[model samples]
Target: MKQMEDVITIEEKNHIDELTGLHNLTGILEHLRGHDKYSASEDTVIIYINVMNFKVFNQKYGFAGGNDFLRGMAHELKNIFPDELVARTGGDQFIVLGKSIDKEELLDKLDDFREAVHNYEKGLKMKIKAGIYRAKGTEEDPVIMVDRAKMACDDIIRVYDRDNNLYTEELDKRNELRQYVIDNFESAFKQRYFQVYYQKEIRAVTRKVCGYEALARWLDPTYGIISPAVFIEVLESVHLIHRLDIYMIDQVCSDLRDDIDSGYAVEPISVNLSRLDFELCDIMSEIDKCRAKYDIPKKLLHIEVTESAIASGADFLGKHIKKFRDAGYEVWMDDFGAGYSSFNNLKDYDFDVIKIDMGFLREFETNQKSRIILASIVNMAKELGIHTLAEGVETEEQYEFLLNIGCEKMQGYLFGKPKPVSEFVRSVDCSFENNEEFDFSSYYDDIGTVNFLNSTPLETKSMEIMIKLPIAIAELHGDQVSFVYANEAYIDFLKTIGAENLDRANEIGRSKERDNASGFANILKMAESSYNQRSEADLVANGYVINTKVRFLSRHGEKAAFALVSRNVTAQKEAHSADDYSAVLMHLLNLYNRIDLFNEEGTFENLFLCGNQKALSDIERKAVVAVQMYSDTHIMEADKERFKKFFDITTVHDRIESSGKHYLVDYYRSALPGDEDRILMYIILPFHYNGKWRFIAGCRYMDELDKLKSVLKQIEST
Candidate 1:
């Protein structure tokens, strides 16, 4: 049987790079335009892979090693889709394209890429994570897809490197800058220090007022209009952008209230909150204060956010976003048409409105490419029963073009510039009181009825908002390597026993044992090696060792990627540190963890009081001698005689930063340790976990029933 090579006449052909056998970026773009896919379908996938660690790799290894690793990975990728592509756009990365498939398959293939690439590793290890998405039907352009991929890849790579302690050094440098912005968010914009600007969204047809989008404008003290992209990126690195969101919400709320009080027709201000904020569920109650103080309607204060907060894959995103949506605040999806994964976000969320990034709207008139995408986006929104909004409508051509394409509404410079809250209020025609409700309310059909009584708001501050940092994967190279994705154990260690390695790669250090157990370094190396050979590894470096069971990730038997399980070592690390505590408590804990103490006599024959309580007289030691009688929640006394140096008697819980663990310290002098000169009595804190008592010893005494005999014996001994 003969197979046909389907060929269409290509006026111009793209030359793929010879070494990697991947298409040059120019070739990829040409190919995109040559194929009708970008002009036709709502489902083409475009992903760009950028080698973030390429510089580090080249510096560590020779240039040849870098190329060899990339080429090998490229070869492995080539085999994944025999008919598709593994085009090298140049440098250490490449581009991949495939049209229309199951979304699950797309994601699985990405996972496989992460796994199989390790198989093709060259002499030096090299790995790259990519951002992926379904192309915007016919409106898709190569550059947009590539940028989206870069952004996605950057996000994943950041999280990935975080696990291995790679980005810790950079983060240290960012802390000062982050703090500066955080402390200045409100005041920074004051005195013309920073300015708040609002961009408006109008009704699709009448071009009337919808609401304004609030953006941060840094009126540079030293410079002017400091690039938002650059500074904003820096703040994100330090995780302080949340403060910016807080500042925006607070200022806008106040500004709106003032305008309304002045007899101005100002509805609630629409401010964009970050996914980080929405997920914290901390803004509701705070907003409520502003709502009541300003006499503003909760519904008027619209929170514009990305779709992720509504239903991102992250463990915490959905529940938190619901806090706002459930409370009766408007939640919108901004930059609706920019990213490839927008549809998934749409499917996952209950969005009141969608704002199409102006980029696409600008191109809609002349670019057939934009027309295809705009239609796809508009049509999709129509089907989902969500409203359509095209942002960045700078030209009449674009506005007219959007309408022709079935886009119901648009916003861009052609209409007007983003004004101040007062100016915007003057611009809008509708009054907040008279308006029944906006069309965006239709998304609530799934939300059912909102109960005002049952719903209470969250605690939010103007600058400080509480958030649970989800555990992310971190990686590091060089000697001071460790996990920057600090979990409880890691943070506990930092708080209890501070590590003063200023040059420390990350907060979570790789334990000495991880050298044998194979920590994040080995995990990444295993993944890198996958790009060349089908190899596996299980080595440890840090104390928190992991059995990174790995296999060469390959497509059709060729090494293309690598995948390994990220075993959580939090519990193991804590358990391993048991011996690091006070000798007495460690001894007691040692006796406690292994054997059942239910039947054994709790009192010790030779009671030797040691530590700070040695100076305390006999009677003072009695409080230190506690009996552990209960199974959970220990009762301990404030013993000051012996353990006074570390914790005052009044302090029941003293925080120890060494292991980042909190300690419930019970300090006192106990004569049982012979004359109260030798030892002090200290009972450890105990909490129930997994149907058993987990202990933090030498800190506080547990006055449970189990220790009653020991308490009596100690009293007699004293």
Candidate 2:
């Protein structure tokens, strides 16, 4: 019997880890199988613990120190949770099983253990994160509990300064969402939820499209639209980013193949390559496969890489970039000046183009320092024998500045926002002609003969003043083909559509249906030769689709002055809404004697509306100061008191506190002398903007205020 007991002890010892003397994975499973899990009256808690930065710890202290630390940690955990199962599940990770401990007690114990790890013997310090799952005694599979704990731990790891987390419904929902993505990613691709949009890059000097950058967008069936900012990171975590990246490359190649087949002029379109793409396989081989499969020229497809990606794998990137150049592909280093080692990257690697980040141009108008820095970067890039592109150039001033500083290319909203490939192709196919005849015989006959060029110098100056008003206006010579004068609005409008001056506008705005300059000239000449007729004509420019009505006036000496009233019809075809929401808000405000719209942060959208100009100015000043300081405590005391009464309501709080809905607060304010006897106001709207909360509130003094109050009451009752 003694010999048999010795054999049993030896077998049990074999199940324990040699280094930490804790149960190995198999032993842990065996121990769990022996538990009367379903009979436990109290909840059983499974904990997953991970040592943070363990790899770095091992690098600094070596494997011997690492092994010693793990063994000590296992012993400490066993002592802390006496009579519980403690096991080394994997590298730098441990699991604990216990019963009867609630969440608060478990968190306290974990916090204490974390602090203990920081103060271990010999000053050997570490930090750990933990996830807890409380079982309801009905679960049969221990693996399910382990996975839940691990998911909780991963959630904690993703956030900073967070140590331990308990599994909750929200985490369960997020896991479901991730699983859906993992399972349906291929289905989504097949169903065409994934799409490519192109943003055009134009030559700064010529203001003509030179290339395009391909951008990916995802339209999820249930979520409507999922931002790449959210989904891409999830995909990267699962090592599936390469799949999406390759799909995007294939789309680019297929588009180019069709464009070439149609015999259209081709532009180099660049696709972004993530660092993971190179890690998975040879990037060049993938590119070669796509190019060969599509039968497109290598030069038509460019490659773009971010600064961080190159910096992380400089040696590999350098070799690959050289291969790209040798194979007739241009390599662009994107988002330059966004990091500290930008210059170092440029020095170490070979790149055909450098794209300056858009951030520098954001403050170019106000910050002299930004201007100086941008100028320095442009000059340095010019000296380095590399082409430079200024990205995010949204304003005319930025475009002109980049042009003057010798930036080879420019891209941003100033040109146009990115659009779907189908829409972009239509825009590219927009063709125009400049040779249509115009006849004004009927109107010219009515004009008979008017004085032509018989105005005094003062009169001419007055006409100039009229033209220079905010409205778009232009003056043409007798021929109406040559521009005599263009007002500021006209010049600005033309520039907005990529035309430099009236001459360029005439050149680019020509269409097959009409000759813009010639048509106007004919109208003026016909008016001059007519009998009491008023001659007129209409001109249209495609692409920008500008429409202008021209009226010809002739003076006594055959000189003609034409007035052109222009409207940009592009907005009618564009996606943004032109309806004035502010007008509706203003009308709502005027119904009350005095009103104000404020965000939750106490910043006012509209000041006092009671015609108290002084009060409005004072409140506006205070509101601006409060927002600048990022504090609600600095707002006027009376305003705070009024707002507090509204926020204090439970229903109102429930609606606006991270609820993504609006609530209303109705209150009364006593009037002063000469004011209305009764004043009722409302702060009934809650909203969020730019990651902050806001509200809309105001009071009105009207006999009909009670009617509006009745309407609001009806809404609430329903």
Candidate 3:
């Protein structure tokens, strides 16, 4: 009896996880190998639990924390399935073997596990995804069942929203296709089966071609045109996507060289880089090599990185993006607003252009929320000095809506679908004449900075406020001024000036009588002067005094673009004297050294600066960078680290939610010379403005000792 017990103990010791005290993979396999118990039972089911983003959690909380988390998960699984055989297979995965369980019951168990995971620790967030696979008694091998369960788990694409999936015959077919892709990828590459297609991006206001995004299409001999959704994901899983990215870069560069040599009009072509590209090789060096080999200008080649790629490996990818930018390549963030971390990505990374995710436009006409979100994204991008481009714009109404919201660029089937380079070149050349004198660089710069919407509250009340402020953006060709965009208020103002709409306003600008009018000529002079200087003018048209401000936006050879803001000052001039207006302006200008306004979500909405302090004046438009700059320049060394922690925008929502406070205040010592004895107080106050929560943040000198103590007491109480 003692010898038999020792054998049983040794067997159990060899097949149990040391950390979780649960059956290991070997133990689970051994149990399934027992023919007497499981071989004849057709009710057996296998559940595979994969903790998504576990690696990121490990990186954040250390291996010891990861072990604790695994152990906790093991405990929860045991409690959830007390009668089943639970096993901690490896890493962040677990397997469970049960009998006679239906699909609905299994899914209910998964939901319970997910809820338990959320409550495991306070302030801890993690995703628990599971896959279910039912086994036939005739299948004796356990490995196949386990793998099928894993495959189902891997098929759950949207990790955040989806919890579990069940394996089916369809998954088996997908598995076969994935395997085929893996086998044929290398041969296909060598045989040049991959082709590069160009999709044109159009300037929203002028409907002219601005650039192209290079997309890859697989022309497999057996399958014909393989869907990128299949091949790209397979390649990424196998860590071979870097090779495809490099191939596309080379192909695009070669195409650009051919187009230039052929005397065809060319624009910047953007190529996407996968997250694996950054992990697998020196991608930047490869891009530089391709550019140099083709002798293509760096500006002609743009780099696009998806938001998921950045979210996966930000620090590593950020360094590579800086290298690309330092080498004069414009980097764009593709598929914006596709994930939960969209705002965080905008705050952390410096992207030249943000490509609004096409999913937002899929239900644009049917969903009011989608329209509001899309407009908010464009407005926020414009405020941050980042260019905005909408993807998947296929309808005239969609195009007009995007144009009205200040989206500078558009790419979709409406302009043209992705086509081969040769075909694209022929189509474009036949459709539009090349402007030999058009300065592409200057034009791109101008359209990139132009924003139609002003910094108003981003809410339902925004439309009301926008209607009250008349704004228009115009394109200037010598004396011919054409209005590209005009809001309802601007159209109303035009009607008051004897013009009905944008078309009529443009026609009046081209008429001989209007050309000789002093008001029209004065407006033109202000626009021309705005190229070198900020200029404003007041003119009487149709018996109303209109105050207009003009700012130069861009120049393309003899053509120019300018943004104009007009307000009828008839009532204001009659109510207040010029001296009162000047006094009001002077008082507002002296309010603060610098003031920044952001939404409750921590997106930078607007900024106002008083003095010409170079350091503060040069801060970037991103909130993350703005806080870092302030900490580096103003806060003392000892307080700098804490100051950063206090000002972290990512934590703002959480802090507000937890504390139920609309404002926060803190004090720190100044780091400037001769200011060692001075203390500065920074306050973040939230107020309801235009139907949204807007935060006004500013720092001021805390001169009075009693006031400083009182503020400190208030902060401590909060």
Best by lDDT: 3
> 319, model 2: CA deviation in Å?
3.4
lDDT for each candidate structure: 0.50, 0.63, 0.76
User: Model 2: per-residue lDDT, tens digit, 1-718?
Assistant: 2322322343377567788877666665554555443223236677999987687678777888788778878867876776566778878999887777777777877876776666443454565889888876566766777788888887876454678888998888888877777777888888989888888777653465667899888888897776675567678788888888888888999988886676555667888888788888777788889989999887788899988678766688888888888888889999898753799988998887888989898888889888767766765664465677889988998887776444667889998787777785443432112101112211221121111111211112211111332122233444435443444555777665556787765554242112244545565566556674334444343333455545554443433454444555553444434335345546765665444456544445545555531234344534545333321432233454555555442345465545533356555443343443544455565433333444545555444667888999999999
- Per-prediction TM-score, please? 0.38, 0.45, 0.75
What CA root-mean-square deviation does each model show from the true structure? 27.6, 30.1, 24.1
Candidate with better lDDT, 1 vs 2: 2
lDDT of 1 by residue, 606-700 (tens): 13333322222222222223322211112123433334333222233234334333344333433332333322234543232222223333422
Please tell me which predicted candidate would have the highest TM-score against the true structure: 3
Judged by whole-model lDDT over C-alpha atoms, candidate 2 comes out at 0.63
Q: Which residue ranges in model 1 land beyond 4 Å of their true spot?
A: 1-192, 279-281, 307-315, 421-718
Candidate 2 to truth, TM: 0.45
- Candidate 3 ranges with C-alpha deviation above 4 Å: 1-11, 36-41, 137-140, 425-438, 455-466, 515-519, 527-532, 542-544, 568-718
